[model samples]
Target: MKLTYYPGCSLEGTASDYAAGIAGVAGLLGLTLAELPDWNCCGASAAHSLDAEAARALPIRNLRLAQRIGLDVVAPCALCFNRLKAGAKDLEAKGERLSFRVWDLLDLLTQPVFLKRMAARLVTPLTGLQAVCYYGCLVNRPPKITDAPTPENPGNMEKLLQTLGATPLEWSFKTDCCGAGLAVARPDLIDRLVRRLYDRARRAGAECIVVSCQMCQANLDLPQARISRQAGQKYELPVLYFTELIALALGHPEVPRWLARHLVDPRPVLAAKGLLEIPAPQASG
Candidate 1:
């Protein structure tokens, strides 16, 4: 199936691995992705808080562009997905009906046909790996815009994890906030939130946290040492993008390159579980 892909800013920068993994998995599944032309930011966490007009307008611009293409839009970033959906709702409220549909990539992947395709291509199932699926905040909250079945607790990622042969731990804080944009401004608060998530996941026997949001991965994965220090405890848990695990299961060649981008290296845990193989070094002339 071909869809218009809205990668958002994170996918082009810090979260390029996520973009790579998504592309890899899509290729493996025979899904075609056509990027939206000249797409702009969807005005994430700060926009709605600062300027409501710009917040709504920015995503609406993209929605209009997708409408022109006449294909469903697939946004991999949770923040982007939320903003686009919000824009669509706002336009609908104003009676400016949009012709296209917006979908979170996870939601699209969870459909029965896609899941069946993924199952057939699984070469390395993540057996024995215990994980906590983190939804952060914006992905499924404000149910009207996101249309999530259970905003307080989402099971899409867990279902995908299970399909990949990983054990998805049932835990609290599945839909809890991950300190969002405050990661830079009030790290003290962010630390506390991260600590709570990590502590709970560890208690639930989760070796890692899997997430669909770039912000959650940045907060939980990038600042582990600082959060550990602040909490007076050590948390060496790996925070992985759901796409990365799917790519691994599909035997993507770039898996090692994508895994190398994580601040909290997941290879040690993956290797220990015999789920990862270190690529052989290239020879020099």
Candidate 2:
């Protein structure tokens, strides 16, 4: 029920809500998230692009700490997860000499015992939700990070969706790009990517788009209005972090907390469907 939780830099700052949401839901799910004693950035895109050794080394430090404590690490950030996963895969593949040891957070979280425990704790009814799970291009690509189901067609998220009682909509955009960092530099390109995903999700009859990558969520969720305007089509799918949907399925009352900082509000869609529940405040410990 417990694993070393690496919140990464984003989770500690602007994405604090994601960290809280994970903590809150983990409590309800009877899961224990133990934070690493000292953790640093996994050097996601920046590190990998600048220096491969440093990029691998950053995640190795955290993983080494986890291995030392005899507990596997669980990274909530997609970029961090990808970095750590890539490092572990490289080490495993080439038997590379390591100044430190490392392991994939997915390795621990997806273990049968942990997954079963998580499924057992998911009691909130999800009879009404039809979600299109998006894994984006980071964690699943380059073949080094995610190990199973291939990048072109992924099912890990769908498996988790089924376990939580929601129907996973079949869609081609699950593993497609959301135009990522290009959102700032080349919004026109990002607009095309977003429109493609939005159109596909709508065609597949998804109630909302579920994502694990924060950057992907930021790109797709925030700019829906602008993208729609540019494409000259009405698109209004509620984009959410997978953790947020999991929290809702766990019967947490504070659903709105997850969307407070979102550029587009999804409360109306949930409200229109009569699934919006005022999330009750949790007593601070």
Model 1, span 1-285: residue lDDT tens:
999999999889998778888999899888899999999998887899999999989999999889999999999988899999999999899898877789998899888898898898899999999999998877797999998899987898999998999999999889988886998899889888888898899999999999988888888998898877776777799999888989888888887778777888888888888888863333110
Where model 1 places Cα greater than 4 Å from the true spot, the runs are: 279-285
User: Ten consecutive residues with minimal summed lDDT in candidate 1?
Assistant: 276-285
What is candidate 2's lDDT per residue for 1-285, written digit by digit as tens? 576777888787766766777777677656687888887788877788889899988977777776667655667766787887787776667885444333233334445665676677765656668889988876667664665457688777787777767789998778887878677788899888888888889889887888876777778877888977887877788777777766766667666767665556666655555556642233231
Error of 1 at 66 (Å): 0.9
lDDT of 1 at 134: 92
Clashing pairs in 2: 253-279, 254-279
Whole-model Cα lDDT of every candidate shown, in order: 0.88, 0.72
The TM-score of candidate 2 is 0.84
